[model samples]
Target chain A: MGNNPHDAGLTEGPAPMDEQLVAYLDGELDDESSRRLEQQLASDSTLRDQLSRLERTWDALDELERIEVDQEFTRTTIEMVALAAEREHQEEERRRPARRRRQWLLGLAAIVLACFAGFAGTWYFLPDPNRQLIEDLPVLQRLDEYQLIDTIEFLKLLRDRQLFPAKTEDASTVREASPVVAAGPSAVNREVGAGVAGKREYEKNRARIEAMAPGDKRQLSDNWRRFDKLSDEKQEELRNLHGALQLEGDREELERVMEAYCEWASDKLSAPELSHLDRLLPAERIEQVAAYKASPRRQFGRRDGFWDMARNPYGTRWFGRGVSGSSVKEYADALKTWAGRYVADRAEVLAELLPREEGTKWKAGLAKAPADDPEQVKSRWIYLVRWYLAGPKQDMPIDGEDVASLEALLSPNARKFFEQIPPEAKKREIPVGLRRMIGFHFQTGQPEFENLIAAEDLDRFRKTLSVDMEENLRKFPSAEKQNEWVRFAYFQSKLPRDARSSRDDRHSPGSARPPYGPPSHDGPSGPRRGPGGEPREPGDGPRGMRPGPAGIPPPPADQPAEKR
Target chain B: MLEVRDDNAATFEELMLRYQNRVITFLEHHTGNHELAKDLAQDVFMRVWRARKDYVPGAKFSTWLFTITSNVAKNAQRSRSRRHEVNLEGRDSGPLGVRPLEAMAQVSSGQIPARALDRAEVRDVVWMAVQSLNERQRAAVLLSKFEGMSYAEIAETMGMSVQAIKSLLSRARTNLREVLEPYFDFGSPPETSDDADSS
Candidate 1:
């Protein structure tokens, strides 16, 4: 073996002969190399013997069994890929909101800069006196109202009195408007013009002041200067009181309440009683006010006037009768009943609108509610709706039908805009999509949905409705309902020209014709027509009239027929 | 592969079907364990799936796949070495650091009766001979022989230069010849200890 060429070659580091022979066997060598190796192999018996052994060993590896994975392996591999895809999709979904928030922040920054530029331009042109007035505009606008209420504590007491009647606006609307107020501590630093919406309101007020007569301007300026004279803490308290009143709806009602409280406090309370009232906490002050009303010592011949002033300042009854304990319970009960009925009527629609898991949870909650106790059921439903709505909007379940209807309603440009959204987001329910579209439409004014209705038809629709779109939005009982109606109107607006013309031709002289088409009398509970056969106001359109194909009513299950 | 990169499941399944057996056979020969080869083959395909998104369509898809296979096999070997667990199917060590095949060779060469070996026994002898090579040598030889990969393709898959692959295959073939020549020349089992001693 030592004398053999193969044994000598193997003893050395990779011999060229061994590499050539292995490459030749593996067909890795070029033809020239193979020929060279073959010549060497024929001439050298040892090299030929070495090549044969390599070939035999390579061939012996063929005895290793062929591996065939079962169908289960293929199935599992596919499942693993699918699971990975879903995880990636969910990760993308998780990242989407942060991206959207960045976009929203960019948009908000642009708006803020534009507003700042406008304000800077105004300030640059304004005289010193007018500039000071502009600086104090928020406080000046409510100067008389704040003047009547000396302290925030007194304002809190008056609020506790329930003297200001709650506005008829829906609770959801108020909640949507005052997020800072609902969030508590953050609301403290959020002055009147701190945010985008507040800035717009501030700009509107500024324009109103700019247009004011000289006498009115002078009066407001004097009020501002007087407000400026107050100590810093007092000024902050007054500003906070104004903010609190603003956060509550109906500032005019609050002003009346302030006036009544001021008049009643000065007349009814002795000096020490007034001092005592001021020292007490809010709840204690409320109790003290009730005590003063009941006390014979302070009871003058105007006891009836005291009761009238304290309980019902404005002759009309409010949600609760008075600040009395029983009346507070009544108010709570009334609010619950209203919320419960609202939720119960729209339960199915709301359920469909929630995410699958949340919808299931909501249904389970409703199922578990005490059937014998209606109040408990209503409270349970309210809790479920609130909990579900408080979560992220991306988690909201979208009804495919609603998305389809909303897409159909979009104008050509709007449809293009909708198509530009990711496919993953296109299936989102109407409220989110409609709100986005409406925001975009207003921001850009590109007639995204405007062209769906002709000018004359839109004018007719607006005149017949007797309110602008903003007021129409306010009239909806819930945010979801508002979106639903907007979606419905848009859908109706896109009806074919021939269809509308033929429907108008068939319309009787006394019958109301909606701008989309003639009202569908075939469906039960079709929209109510006005006296002169005009379309009823938008919010007044029958709650049951869900927009279906060609403005027909959807199935009964989808229709929340009960009034909000 | 491009279709797989675009998240087409059917194309991925088809690719798996076309390559699964070959991958498993290569891993089995590389690892010398059937069950582990099946498991590692799945891991190789999973790596393929994960890497699909970043897969550039330049190299042959098989080259990319076998590259993943080589890494996975190397990692499995490294971990098994760390665990200090002897791979019983491909046991290279016997008494006194001598391989079991060397002992069998000695036994067959001695007066110990040489029984008529069946096809399974020949396969086992061949498996022990292949396993007697070092990890890189085993991979190079198995890929070149069973996978029918060229030296350049094997180098690409193993992340080595072609010259290195040529040298590797030369040394691997020499080792295999040393281990399998006795069994090929005579009816005796191969000597697995001499290659270990030489390396």
Candidate 2:
């Protein structure tokens, strides 16, 4: 509609003519514009050329590839939408329960308003049965234990007297420090919190009750009925006892004591006598129980058997089973054979346990001993086996001096590997390996000192030493001494080149190499001394020089070991 | 579409079957990445499913669907730019950087030998030229050229005025002409330029 003749013909630069030309190519122009564009295209060569270019470029867009999505895309999209819908539905369901509870409360309120006096009487005299069950669920869970005791006072008196002793020999030692009465009310209160804890306990009890089988549920209900008939004072006492027994540490000990007492009372006392004792006061009842335990009539024929049974009810009666001397000999021979095989398997670790002279002599004796001489072989096997078993128990604390000696004994490659461990990790890893080396030397007897030295580092330690050092190490009479020299050489190599030459001149190989002494706090070659220049401790001898049980020497403290 | 709005699942599936290929094709051309296009196409359909309860049946369903598609695509492009990971297929060139066709521009401008390009090369040239357009211009051109929507429908799909869409299409065509006209007229391939027109 504009009167510019230039606009009718296509011009550049945001002109309406460009839009008209594009629209004309797209067949989107109005009739008047289409007619005018056609007339202009026929006469104006520039406009025709411009239209041709637009038409050609627009058509070239068809060259872009057509794309098709696979069936999986459709399937996954449907699944995603379905999952979203299900989540929405679940959200609605979660909201419905609160709404239902509100409606129930409103209905209850209306009924109460309509018949206040009647509802109050019913609610007071016959409270909701389900609510009562939930409130008493904790007691119902332990109804069987409560049914046996007349009152908590009686149980407390029984525990105070220590009438039910531990049935096992070791059990007495384990439980001696943690007596049932020692756990005070404050401890119990600390263990169990109020309010939130109470609600959680109720929910837990309800879930357990609901999961019980129908027959068990019926029996529980029966117990509840019997329990319900007790006086309110008795019910309160039983509930208090149950809550006290729920304390974690005391529960197991008290349960065991109760079990032992129950078993003994049922076996010895008559039902009438038991009932009579229960009717007495807790103090008098416990006194009577103690008297019955010590009675001459109860002990006349079966004191030893009863005490033995009390001491170890689950233990096999190996001592009382009579056997011939020949049978005993046969058993001893079998045990000797097993011990010999075990000693042979751990020969390297056992060798490390003795002094250089003793170990060399023992190895020579074993090599020369006649294979068919059972007596000599048995004696040799017993020597090594005794050393293995009679060493320090597995749980012994690793001495810090022993750990320092072990660190001084690491080979060059192992030292490199050990130094790379972060300092915090070294504190943990060094002790674990040292403990295994000391306590389970037989198990760690495989090559490479498996617990202490990594296999690759051990291999490199043996393979990478100079010809002179290897020759010097081979001259040592025992593996332990050879290891000490390797460690000394590794430390020597760490010194500055000039200092090493001076130290080597003074400690030349033939002049009796210095004893494997404790590491010095000062420079590498300084005297080994404690912080105040005191002498080293007794156990600070060379590796494997520490005294073992029965006067035998245990293995030298080896390298810092790690669990593989 | 009304059935789909009423939560008719079978109708939704039918609609997906009808539109999946078209939607994926449009997105693939729009984003220059087939896998991302598939992901974005699924996202578009997912939004439609989520907003089904609010869907009103006035505009054409493809138009409504493309509106969601346009928004999803733009959001993806915006985030991709924010991450500074806008290169096409890990090539150091795309709409926001130097165009891949700069090398081809060198070839067209006779710095390199003018060998006859293959069909796939020509297709790639056209794809790069399309991708060089700005986000809105690219969406508009794709909707117009592939979807065959009128200027009004493109305006509705892009949430722009009819005049803006007209201007957008005109500039896009003019850009394509600058890049592709030589290829269409001669054996030389299309070259993307530094100052290629974009809205």
Candidate 3:
């Protein structure tokens, strides 16, 4: 009757009795409902029977008893709660100063913004033609007129041009017009009868006479009309000695003159190079300075490679000079190799960090992937490198559209692994191939590398390589032989599997190892071979077959090219 | 509640003493283990103390107190499932007393007359019947009988509506009547397995 099949005989055709019965048995019914159920129970045997059973079940739950709880339980809980509160209080106190500093920075930024707005408004709206004309006045004036003119002569020209109007021939008028020169023979008095051009010439010579020293001034006073036309360089040289000539003590004057040439040389040297030289002992500093002066001037043309640009301290590269193009390429290759070495080092670190199963999976991933396509390999490497460099905690937002492509390229686990790598490790252990790639990519305007390798660092790297190159040249008979020696250096350093230590001494190149280039997927295998396709010796390869160009100086006769 | 919120330690201890026995009784019936009930009761009071500042005092103190009790019970039940302990043998004594099977045998002995069970036997019989119900029904019945809460008050404490509470209690009573009617000698128990009463 009330969709109440589950209630069975309790209800006929009215509201369901299931809830009513449960409530009634629990004494939850209102007064009206309670009276109604009571009346029904008195009249109906079936209703009374249902009520009786429900009451029995409800009353049966009274069997559960209140048991005693240990007193120590209450004591320990209160202690824990107090400790938690105290910890929270300390944390809040620690954060107060940091919060105050953030507020102060916000206030300062607002003040600076307001001041800039006001200054911009004034500069844009205010316009005065007289001010504009004064700025433009220089373009209208002729150069020859000012060449012989001192400060006073220019003011007279200003008046002659009617830029300033004169009042009369009064004392006050002359004082205001030329206060600096009023005590001398005034320009106004000269203009009264003398030829205008002749008067200009007289004033120029008079100004020169006043500025000269006592000896020159006395000679000028004797023949004030004629002046010697000394060359510009001689004039500058003479002027440089002027302070010393005026010294009161003869001994001090002589000392100053004697040190002038050294002062001139100091200005010509590179500041960093000179500072480094200063740190050396006096004897060493002298030798270094001599070597620097004798070092041939390298043409650092714009066409020259990055290595040449690195060698020049001032960073000026001309179009036509320095090392040959091939040598520049060789240095560039070494940098690229160094970058590759860094990546390999990081791979070793990664292998250690990965769990056993994951490490195996990663190795499989690398082995299964194609190694022939360099671009694909590079892209995969870059993806890992980019994620590694961003740091573990970095949250990079990706568009919904990009999710599929990223998932296709890298597995979710691999992506998470990259995120977990700490950035501090990335900075300290720059992957060998990454630095050169970053430098080259950033050459096209990548700003991320600004912190990685600054200009100063690049210069230092170049200087070290340049020194290595010089040493290499002196060790080999020719440039071709040196290049050949570098290719086989790594393998030759270690003897064949059975070779003895005594054999190592026969060909060891000492501690001077050649720069190792980046490893290729199909790197050289087996034994080493020289450029001529012959097995290389331990130290220097076969030499003295031919000499290179004139620029390469020969080694000392006692140490032959083949003996290195 | 305000005294505890203000860090009055004595007031908090007094409150704990008043409610500790009631909480332990409810949890023992719900879990069918008196020892676990005592531990869970301690946890409930600790939570109340920790969350004292958050209390608004809108509801009765018992209502707030029981809410935390229900939460701790539910969390412990979930962890127990994940751990999947196959047997809890040799741990017959719970927060209350002996195992339900042993209690059933003691109550069923020919020596005890129907309707004349001793207080200890009655408590055991009732606890055995409570274990027959599911977790929610057990909690609902414990709150109603032990705490003396009405349908609406139980609903508020358990985060359910009054109508739902009434339905829950009805089903719970039907299940209990079937399990308990035999002990009272009113009717025979239906052919049922005791495996479902392992709680």
Cα lDDT over the full model 1: 0.51
Error of 2 at B27 (Å): 0.9
Ranking by TM-score: 1, 2, 3
Model 3, span A477-560: residue lDDT tens: 233333322322211222122221222211111111111212211112112345795544432311331221111222322321
Instruction: Point out where model 2 deviates above 4 Å.
Output: A1-13, A96-564, B88-117, B185-188, B191-193
TM-score of chain A of each: 0.23, 0.26, 0.16
Q: Is candidate 1 or candidate 3 better by lDDT?
A: 1
lDDT of 2 by residue, A1-564 (tens): 123343332213346777888988888888998998899899998677667657766766755666656557867776666565556555655677776756645543443342333333443555554555655655654554454555556666667788886355444553332332222112243244245665465555566668876644754564565456456777776666765665545565665666567646544453224445656787788888898887743311111111111111111111111111113234334334434544554555555655556555555655664556666555454444333222222211223443354444443323443455555544444433322222222221212122233346445656767564464345332454345334323322322233222222211111111122223211222222346865333223222233221111222223211111
The DockQ score of candidate 1 comes to: 0.08
Candidate 3: lDDT over CA atoms?
0.41
| Model 3: CA > 4 A from native | A1-15, A85-564, B86-117, B186-199
- Model 1, A1-564: lDDT tens per residue? 434555555634566777788778878788888887888878887777677667766766755545556666666665665566556655655667765766645544443344334334433554553544554565665554455465666666666677543455544553322333322211343453476665565455567678876645645654665565466787767666756766666544555566456545543343225445655776677777777766654311221112111111111111111112112334334444444544454566666655678666666666566545666744553443343332323333345554564455443323544555555556532333222222222222222233433456544544543234445344322343334344434433433233233222211111111122323221211223557865543222122332222221222222111110
Task: List the TM-score for candidate 2's chain B.
Answer: 0.81
The weakest ten consecutive residues by lDDT in model 3 chain A span A312-321
Ranking by DockQ: 2, 1, 3
Q: Each candidate's interface RMSD, rounded to one decimal?
A: 45.3, 41.1, 44.0
